[model samples]
Target: MELQRLRDVFRTALDLPADAPVDDLHYQDHEKWDSLAHMSLIAALEDEFDVMIDTEDVINMSSFGEATRILGKYGVDFNG
Candidate 1:
């Protein structure tokens, strides 16, 4: 459920297809994910998860896998 929610956030922020593979997407992996879109994606994730991400982590949030790991630090239970 949380993963799906993150995918939704990606779709909204990155302008991807509703059925696009968001979990494996990385920053620059898709043409739509420029720096502007990266910040937009970050904002969407922050808003959706209600978690404040540090600037360093924002830089490190380059992939969905890494993102889930980072979000885990904020108490987002990916297992749920």
Candidate 2:
């Protein structure tokens, strides 16, 4: 599940590389992840996880690592 989430995040957030390092993800650290991309990312994540992320979380999600942590709060177990 974690791997799938990571992959989805990467595919949605273009700032990340094909093989992005999950431990070092950040939004402002890349060019492709602009405002539009972030919106797309949120949509993708919501569809993939089948959860409606809050607006605050959408704004606060600035990295893959941050996303993982935030989603975990919503019962997305990474251990899977």
Candidate 3:
């Protein structure tokens, strides 16, 4: 559901493999998750989830798990 969609967005934005484990990924830690990729990831997330992310939240989104928590603030439910 929403979690899978978020994973898909991460995969597409970061150009990751379909089976890549995103839960533990951190910005600038992953080879592909650079600054440019971070912006792409943010845009993809906003588009996919239909929410406008704040600048502070964008800066705070340093990890995949953190992204999930931030999205939760925007009404995205990870728990079914």
Best-fitting candidate, scored by TM-score: 3
Every model's TM-score: 0.96, 0.79, 0.97
Error of 1 at 55 (Å): 0.4
Which tens-of-lDDT digit does each residue in 29-74 have in candidate 2? 7667778888988887787778899999999998888888888887
Candidate order, lDDT descending: 3, 1, 2
Worst 10-residue lDDT window, candidate 3? 16-25
Per residue, candidate 3 scores C-alpha lDDT tens digits across 1-80 of 99999999999999999999998999999899999999999999999999999999999999999999999999999998
Query: Alpha carbon lDDT of residue 24, candidate 2?
Result: 63
Candidate 2, 17: how far from true, in Å?
Answer: 5.8
Residue 49 lDDT, candidate 1, scale 0-100: 100
Compare candidates 1 and 2 on lDDT and give the better one.
1
Q: Report model 1's TM-score to 2 decimal places.
A: 0.96
Q: By summed lDDT, which 10 consecutive residues of candidate 2 come out lowest?
A: 15-24
Task: State each model's CA lDDT, in order.
Answer: 0.92, 0.76, 0.96
